[model samples]
Target: MRPEIIRLLNENQEFRLFVRQNPQWYRKLSRDPSALQSLEKEANYFYGRTFPQRVERMQSNLGLAMMMMEMLKMGQDTVAQTQETFSS
Candidate 1:
């Protein structure tokens, strides 16, 4: 491994983790340090570690949760209305 690549692996936890998970990158990077860019892009895409991807995932989860809450509230309201009708 090149000195710069060694230093990068030591300094960047994310890159280190990525390389650990995908050992092929180690040989690729050792042969051509310039491949680091493509490796990072692939890692980001594979892990959904990019900011926009993370934000989109969070938004989708929030929307799902909100819809669930709305459904629960509507269910409760229906039960209450049914009870009121029976009591009358």
Candidate 2:
């Protein structure tokens, strides 16, 4: 993944969700369970320490930023279109 994408996910809704969803393949107790157990323990600690509400806050901020970014892009596109029409 792109670094910026990873950064957004890390700062926003991704790491927690990735940790939450990482262990789906470990559905059964087995002889080689140490890795899975370690991951679970780490995830548990991470989740325990994280304020889940921050995820919601980050999402809201991201949404607002995206809206503004989109508006700016549209504004630029509109300017380009107006310039083209005037040139023609």
Candidate 3:
């Protein structure tokens, strides 16, 4: 669940969008008794029946994911550029 959620709330929005499009994702979450109960608790305490709260968290995670992605991309690009220069 954690990984999937992270993937969803990522720079690559396809996983998130896929989960949204597929009801199975929600259903699976619902069927997970432990996780569902825990989520309900989180929902009640944090979200308090407000969808915006959950979305806010999701967006925050997405922002983090994007940052990580940018950092990784920058590193890779740097390495590639360095290799090109050194190899030349």
Candidate 4:
């Protein structure tokens, strides 16, 4: 397989599935310039659809991490306050 096609399969799960499902198309893509161009465009489309969902999940994870940090800080502050009050 061409390095480009290998990379495409590695990066895009949908493309991997499509290639597996359409072996004849994969052969065509390898031999025909026009078919390769069309496959590349389809791969780009699939990745474009997936990229936004990946970004949204990352954002959600970041927000959850920030919330956890804030809660941890609050817990630390409460512990310090209780220690100071008891010592006094």
Candidate 5:
């Protein structure tokens, strides 16, 4: 491994973890230091560490939450309607 790459592994915990999780990157990077860029990009996407990935994840979660809220509101409305009918 190159000194720069070694230093990166030592200094950046996320990079180290990514490299550890994806051992194939280690060999690729050792063969071509320039492959570091691609490794980082793949790692970021894999781990949901990038801004766009994070945004997409948040959007999906938000949609799920909104759906749950709508379901809950519908349930409450149904209960209220049922109570009104029973009272009448």
Candidate 6:
């Protein structure tokens, strides 16, 4: 199954309820390419909206990680300089 289809089923209560209520129709769509084209379009719509949010979240996480790395590097340099001053 497509991940988008599974995501739609898992995330959208209305869509999941519709599928639960119309199991036969959903199954028919699962087999019918023409019907599935519309369903895929709906899934694509959801995916399009979700993809950007995911990327933004990833970028935020990456930025935080880089900041932490820089802080760690600076702390290490500070400790190294302190050790050298004490030894001299």
The global C-alpha lDDT for each of the candidates, from Candidate 1 onward, is 0.93, 0.60, 0.63, 0.77, 0.91, 0.70
Winner on lDDT between 1 and 6 is: 1
* Model 1 TM-score relative to the real fold: 0.77
Q: Compared with the true structure, what per-residue lDDT tens digits does model 5 show for residues 4-67?
A: 9999888988889989988988899899999888987887888888998889999999999999
Report the number of the highest-lDDT candidate: 1
Of the candidates numbered 3 and 4, which has the greater lDDT value? 4
Residues 10-86, candidate 2: write the lDDT tens digits: 67563437544764423322334434455445555566544665676688999999999999999999999999999
Query: What ranking of all candidate models by lDDT puts the best one first?
Result: 1, 5, 4, 6, 3, 2
The candidate maximizing TM-score is 1
Using all chains and alpha carbons, the TM-scores for the candidates as numbered come to 0.77, 0.42, 0.46, 0.47, 0.76, 0.48
After superposing candidate 3 on the true structure, give the runs of residues whose Cα lies further than 4 Å from its correct spot: 1-49
Residue 26 of candidate 4: its Cα lDDT?
A: 70
Candidate 4 off by > 4 Å: 1-49
The 10-residue segment with the lowest total lDDT in model 4: 41-50
> Residue 40 of candidate 3: its Cα lDDT?
42
lDDT value for candidate 3? 0.63
TM-score of 3: 0.46
Question: Which pairs of residues have clashing backbones in candidate 6?
Answer: none
- Report residue 75 deviation for candidate 4 (angstroms): 0.2
Query: In model 1, which residue pairs have backbone atoms overlapping below 3 Å?
Result: none
The digit string of per-residue lDDT tens for model 3 on 8-48 reads 33644543455466556565664563454444444355423
Per-residue lDDT over 1-88 for candidate 6, one digit per residue giving the tens place of the 0 to 100 score = 4556667678877556656765764765566635655654555555554677778879999999999999999999999999999999
